[model samples]
Target chain A: MENDDTEYPVRYIPASKVLQAKVPFLDVSPNIALKKANNVLEEMAKDYVNWVQEDIKRLESTYQDLCEDPKSKDAITALYRVSYAMKGQGGTFGYDLVTFILNNLCRYLEEREEFNEGQLELIELHIESVRMVITHELTGKGGEMGKQVIMGLKQMINKKG
Target chain B: MSAKMLDLSNINILIIDENANMRIIVKQILRALDAHTTKEASGGAEAFTTLKTFNADIILTTWMMSPINGVEFTKMLRTSSDSPNPMVPVIMLSGHTEARYISEARDSGVTEFMAIPISPKSLYLRIAEVVLRPRQFVQTNDFFGPDRHRHDNEKYRGELRRQEDKEKQQDEMELTDAHNSLLKPD
Candidate 1:
């Protein structure tokens, strides 16, 4: 390798050994660690059914606030943050539809401003769809209805965008 | 190494997110992995305070936060003179997996980006990568943090650039030439 030592503003620090010394690789099977972790998530999923309702309520209230003041950039951004949480949690709890819906919503909200009537309505439709999924315990793919809801949302996103 | 298990219990890890529930979820997952020492903070400010004494080896943070967000927190960790464990690996957690969001986190010095709705497998993989394959840290006039490049002749790790960086890099080449002269066969 050429020593391109330009008197550059860059300074390179060697990789830190502070953590490595403590987290050394051991002979234990990776499967054991993975199994333990999966167990934890499986346990959490049980309560996720109840916890997700609060998230939906927060999502609804944020949407309502955005509806009241469509011009408020903060309101729109806050709404997105609420959706962000749901997007992360939904899949872990078997609410893949919620994850899918909120994931799409976050993309729409990213750097988005000026929510026209159609856009707002579309947003509302998404929230309601998510609510329906959770309320019905539509876990895996939500079967046929899940397909329809996801397809409908995609179409609306195209039109709204 | 492939057959070996990762030991997370020996090292301290920090969880920083505004959402309490997310913190719990991450903590539980870490616990399952046998992580014995872990700390939690509500947001960036709390994270800084926690850093004062915790000496965390890894930091898992959320993207969107009130007051000071993940990006802001990362910049501080990389640049702040008083920052505790400034070289600690930062893994950003965000449900928004958009390129822009991930790029933004990377630009600000995140060591790893984990798009959320996270699974135990994905989470474990991320932790394993950061632990097993730590990246070199790079500091420049404009940015300071983990070298962004995974490979390639130590390329400039920062995306944010200035006219001066170009000029400064030119100066670096001149210095490199001078240093190379010592290696020449006379």
Candidate 2:
């Protein structure tokens, strides 16, 4: 009989050893640990909120430059980077609305090889939406207002597409 | 296996993501899972450097990053001679769950795929799967990664059903020969 189990040799980390180590972080938290964890995460997310606000300001300034010169690829590139970062960070920080807004922005920017006036306007709207989401600290895909904003943006994006 | 039976305290996890907040969130989840020793890297290059110094039991990385993405990093880990640990299980985290993206990550040797907005339970389940029921590693001329097949079903007929039995036998012989050629000499 052929040895069907013949396989490559690889070092396997034993689960027993891992289970033996002490987890101090978990020990300190009481029941409702996830909520406690969320509180801590919320505190940490505040710092990122400040950073995103600053980045949004930068995006606004860059948008101004693009307005003066549509061919300012640098501004567009900068805009894309800020939006892309926000898209990745929003949901992680419990700001799913920000993630949703930036996700649309990032997808729009990614699809375009170049930015024209109409596309630039769309980008501005997306940026403003992101700014609003962060400014309000809207979490979990904003309530009714968030849905309206997202729907509005989606309509514009689809029309553009 | 239940999560209660699995212990993750001693596990050293390395999380690589371009976004700082994402790294922080993932760390919190790991800590919630009773994982004490965790490391963070902002990008793949930094992760590669960290791997050389800190031996991680498993890796959780994002799919998109500048200069070096998760797929590129996984390829290097699997194929690069200088890799610190080629066989360490890797779980790729991404907001993009498009089929193509998942397929790309899977093809790059990732052991598991996790979508963003991950809950602690989902993350723990993935960890348990990797630690408890790891897939056998496969090595071939063009591939070196975990076997994609996880279940054995006698009723499930694969693509071989399209071919005659005799042709399938011939194909199996050729595959066996190819696999043998990849093995190291004694």
Candidate 3:
């Protein structure tokens, strides 16, 4: 049995000492570990991108329904909750890119900010850009699409501010 | 009830996450668990300030943060006993599945490690585990109560909003060379 007296964040204990030792947080700076840990995070980000894409579709559909009837307080509350969940999980998963994009999306929802068509389009494009980034991170092929989307978002935010 | 879990109403829990939505989600989870009051921080520096001032009974912090990540922050906290602030129990949260992450967190004086997507049930269970078995989890601190905690969630939330807006504006305006560097090597 391993010693139970071991303190965390200092002594590393794992089944395979070799694989465990390479757990980058213990040895390397976060910048370097980002690369070492990228493989699993890339896979996780791919899965999460699919999840977020589905969520965005659902959110957009709900928003459209609410715009038609504007009285679905329960639906609105639930939408906020889902946005909050995405924000939490996105940050936790080491997908700060996803987190950044979702945070912007959530801010619009939280503030109940009425989005003009152009602003709504910008938000959608940002979400799509985040999705493209996740895809690129996963498959290393969608880099240009991701960059273009990010560039567009930059232009929009800059123009608005 | 089985073994009588720790009464959260009496315990001052500090939740630290760099994300505002995360702070809200974790607060909602605790609130669902009948926890009436939770001290929250958006980042490690803010968390430290809150801990020094409010003095929580237990701390729940996310592992990754800008400026000071959870592991480094906890290490700094464990050393704060010699400073003005005394020791406090810390629970570190992580999304990674690797056990070594937990080990590192533990070694750095983290009281417990709870995997992320921090739902009410998982957070309550983790808190119960730590509060129940202090010797195995964290060193007991007799100086924690709800009354001692400051009700500054609103203030912290406002400050966080300002910071987030500033960061977003900067990201938009500068499109700094550092942005691409943060993503991956070109």
lDDT of 3 by residue, B49-104 (tens): 78667757678888767678888887777665543343456777765325566557
> Which lDDT tens digits does candidate 1 get at residues B57-140?
889998888889999999898888888878889998877566676778878999988877777666776777677668888877
Indicate the docking level reached by candidate 3: incorrect
lDDT of 1 by residue, A1-161 (tens): 12234676577878877677888666666667767878888888888878888988888899999999998988988898888878888887678898888888887787577688898988998898998888778897999888888888888878875
The order of the candidates by TM-score, greatest first, is 1, 2, 3
Residue A36 alpha-carbon offset, candidate 3, angstroms? 40
Q: Which residue runs of candidate 3 sit more than 4 Å off their true CA positions?
A: A1-161, B1-6, B81-86, B136-186
Q: What's the TM-score of candidate 1 when only chain A is evaluated?
A: 0.86
lDDT of 2 by residue, A1-161 (tens): 11233464433222232322432223232224445556666777778778777778877887787777776667666676666666766776778887777777767766765777788878888888887788777778688878887888888877765
Winning candidate number (TM-score)? 1
**lDDT tens readout by residue for model 2, B1-186:** 111234567778999988776777789877865677999999888998999999888899987787898999999898898998888889988766766777788789898887766655456656655665466666665667766555434234344434546455322112222222222132
The global Cα lDDT (0 to 1) of model 1 is 0.79
DockQ in order: 0.40, 0.13, 0.04
Clashes of each: 4, 0, 13
C-alpha RMSD over true interface residues, model 2: 12.2
Candidate number of the best DockQ: 1
